[model samples]
Target: MGSEVHECHLVCGPPAAGKTRYARVLADRLGACLLDSDQVTERLVRAGLLLAGRDPDDRDSVAYKEAYREPVYETLFELAREHLPRGPVIIVGPFTREGGEPDGLAGLEGKVGQNVIAHFVWCDPDERKRRIEMRGETRDLPKLADWDGYLTSCREDRPCWPHRFVDTT
Candidate 1:
């Protein structure tokens, strides 16, 4: 995969699935550009431009997700478009919902017409719960209280894109 030129590798999974850590290692190993939603959103929030909710800093809020999630995803993919031509890129995020198919990558494929590799990270439910709790972020709602129901919500997920899967724990 390293020898492949101008590739875009999208590393996807739910929050706390270890996609960020895995992609960080992979990007360094491959010397690829890494574009991540959390990093980008953090920047936006720091800039005081991404409140999207009643609580300006509460990511767990529905209004925040409604306003920022897709926009963040779009920004990361656009950043990938700029970097991918020179080398490979790893974009890490929960870009897709827990139980949904991968859509066209913000329509980046047709525009760039380049190879876009995809991989999804998976972790054991118990371990994932532990990790999320350890992180203790504001975004862990919905899952923090009812992990079993969250699991059910994502039970039917199957990505439309053909890809590989990695177990993070």
Candidate 2:
């Protein structure tokens, strides 16, 4: 892409890692535009899934990952692009797939411009589980039901890109 760098902040971590809370504080401090995936797309995605004969609350299903994930991210990037020129843009999400990819930040820069400040927000496993349980969202039921399996699936290492680590624990 162009050498021109826009201020884009990516706040990522596993579910219940306090990403949203952290993003809110960061956005407030930076006077940035916050575009949270769950806030922007969760309801619509849930509806879309239901219409497609899928469980609306099925956040961990392969079907959701394959079909809805990319589009959901695309929508966020589109919004970020629209707001970037005005000021900093903070995007909050559990970027599990992107974090694992070697060119994750590169791919994001291509989409939402450059100078991306990536933040990986996380917490102790016990605290994460506690938050998940306290939240009590339908989408979190599956995760709570299979906590060990979820932990196994999570990537313990930091993202394969330049980023700041935020421990909410």
Tens-digit lDDT string for candidate 2 (6-49): 57999999888899999999899999999999999998999999
lDDT of each: 0.70, 0.89
RMSD of 2: 2.5
On residues 21-81, what C-alpha lDDT tens digit does candidate 1 reach at each position? 9999989999998888788768675345334335444554466677677777778767877
C-alpha lDDT of candidate 2 relative to the true structure: 0.89
Off by over 4 Å in 2: 1-6
Model 1, C-alpha of 37: deviation from truth (Å)? 0.7
Q: Give the TM-score of candidate 1.
A: 0.77
Segments in model 1 whose C-alpha atoms lie over 4 Å from true places: 1-5, 46-53, 56-62, 97-99, 102-108, 111-113, 154-156
